[model samples]
Target: MFTSTTIGDLYQIILTNTLICALEDLTTRLNKYKLTACNSDNVENEFTALLENNIRSSCLPIGVENFDGDLAAFFVIENVEKMILKPWGAKNLSLESISLGQYKNEIAAITIKLEDQRRRLTPKLYY
Candidate 1:
């Protein structure tokens, strides 16, 4: 159902309505990254665009089903980690910026917890 509007696009919209409506503070981040405004002519901010695109692609491959606060934090952590590994100048993308109010270590711990939950085994039943 996903179409290519960018000529070279390869998947469903990287940032969908669910992402925009379901997730909070996304617009704020978009504004912060200056992606809220339409580009002029061929001028585009590839770096900031890639920041959101890559993080979404990396975190949720099939795309978001519904909004989960844990998933939201996970996505934020992924972004923060990306910025830390390959920073974009002196710019910062803090969780506080999105009002998550979690420290870096806390985000890591939450991520670990989420991963553990994903790997957790469910009790089997014979039917």
Candidate 2:
């Protein structure tokens, strides 16, 4: 039987799609702004900055906090997917089993705690 996707999976898909769209849009904007032919470092810097700004503007409305934005921006600048795809050891073991566990608890705890802090820290914005 084809069970429906869980909400978590759905949200992940949404976020991943959003990030992919942002990556594409940023590239287009960079081209328009004449950064397309620039050095790689400059291009990466601009993309990271643009990602940071977009997270502040677009993602804040959708409930993503400044920290999440910063983390996501870092991931984009780091080419996290590419890093993940690269072979890690002699046997070419998959990376997810190692890294996902570290992130799962840490990210969940931080997001939850920081969300509480965020609400308390700036009640006006939240309210």
Candidate 3:
């Protein structure tokens, strides 16, 4: 027997993979930092708190435009499954929420990049 693929399936796979990779990268970077210190509990606490704040502040904002774009792309892929299927109208609220999510991811990536750069610049300290 033969099998077929659907656009929705592909989009879901791509989105899931992207999210997994991002999370893995973030975890690896954090673990590397965590292992670098050889200090007292209090010092570790302080440093960890500071890094947490920096990561939170570096995240991006997801706007409606970003969400709508992603949704539109998704719809396009879905439409490929059946040419006669009409595009679903975009929801402003959903778009906004998705945009915010995208912004957060962007911010996370920035945080990771910053941490990586910092580690590279001070290899003796972090490594």
Candidate 4:
């Protein structure tokens, strides 16, 4: 089951197993390396596209949306210790790598948030 969320006039996408996350908020969750070299104007759009494409190409669980962002990021972190940030200053792309620990932290926080969301949304019946 999927529930959609929209924030302001910005964008929203499924970020985890549970939550359709606000891109504005999720952008802050990304580490410096992920944001590096990304045009300041389009970081959220770029990352959202990257995550969606990665999720579609990967063979994750069926119930998990093919466009899930958290799973995609988690998968990438599992495969590599560092993510290359594209070059900031040069017209030529300059890429840099950094620890995936911050990414892991982002995933962990999302997991916690997912747990809370699930708990809050679960039905409670009293007779």
- TM-score of every prediction relative to native: 0.22, 0.24, 0.23, 0.32
CA shift at 95, candidate 4, in angstroms?
Answer: 5.8
Clashes of each: 0, 0, 3, 1
Best by TM-score: 4
**Model 3 C-alpha lDDT per residue in residues 7-124, reported as the tens digit of each score:** 1222332333344454455445433332222233233343334434454221111122222222111111111211111112422211111332343355467557755765566637
lDDT, candidate 4, equals 0.38
Clashing pairs in 3: 59-107, 62-99, 62-100
Candidate 1: where are CA atoms >4 Å away?
A: 1-44, 48-62, 66-108, 118-121
Give the better candidate number (3 or 4) by TM-score: 4
Question: Largest lDDT belongs to which candidate?
Answer: 4
TM-score of 3: 0.23
lDDT of 2 at 94: 18
Encode model 2's per-residue lDDT on 1-127: one tens digit a residue. 0122111222342343343344444334323331123333454454445444554321111332211322221122233311111111222211222233343344445455645664566637453
TM-score rank order: 4, 2, 3, 1
Clashes of 2: 0
- Alpha-carbon local distance difference test for all models: 0.31, 0.31, 0.31, 0.38
Lowest-scoring 10 consecutive residues by lDDT in candidate 3?
Answer: 78-87
